[model samples]
Target: MAALILILLLALILGGAGFAVHILWWIAVIVAVLWLLGFVFRSAGTGGTRGRWYRW
Candidate 1:
């Protein structure tokens, strides 16, 4: 998702879509940054956060 957004951003900037780029640039940047933050802070998915829920 984030990679696709980045590609689209690059394309918009390089393709001379000035108005489109100006409007959507913040959205693309926000999505990409949020994705990065989620990747960095995500749990290990080992059921540690679930505690006894998995055992039940």
Candidate 2:
């Protein structure tokens, strides 16, 4: 009975950690995508600065 309780506690802890990792992975992906998009726009804007004010 004590062994079963210990197993259940370990499983619960692992499950919670897995869920936390999943949430962090999604957040990392979103941040990476936003950073990539910002980098692309920065490169494009600097390539040609003339008459680009109205483009925005």
Candidate 3:
């Protein structure tokens, strides 16, 4: 009985980890798209040339 409970707990933990990883992947994709859009539509800065959207 204890072994069965341990197996179930392990499965639950692994399943939760998998779900979290999937969500992180989606977030990464969204951030990448936003970054690309920012690069494409960046505003002009000093010298009348395009400047980085991010300070870094």
- Candidate closest to the true structure, highest TM-score: 3
lDDT of 3 by residue, 1-56 (tens): 99999999999999999999999999999999998999899999999988889888
**Tens-digit lDDT track for model 2 on 1-56?**
99999999999999999999999999999988987766566533554663232234
The runs of at least 3 residues in candidate 1 whose Cα sits more than 4 Å from the true structure, single-residue gaps closed, are 1-17, 47-56
TM-score of each: 0.44, 0.70, 0.90
Q: Which candidate tops lDDT?
A: 3
Runs of candidate 2 with Cα error greater than 4 angstroms are 43-56
Name the 10 consecutive residues with the lowest summed lDDT in model 3.
47-56
Pairs that clash in candidate 2: none
**How do the residues 1-56 of candidate 1 rate in per-residue lDDT, one tens digit apiece?**
99999999998788777777877998899988987876666655565562222223
Alpha-carbon shift of residue 34 in model 3 (angstroms): 0.5
Better of 1 and 2 by lDDT: 2
**Is 1 or 3 the stronger prediction by TM-score?**
3
Question: What lDDT does candidate 1 reach at residue 19?
Answer: 75
> What local lDDT score does residue 20 receive in model 3, on the 0 to 100 scale?
100
lDDT for model 2: 0.78
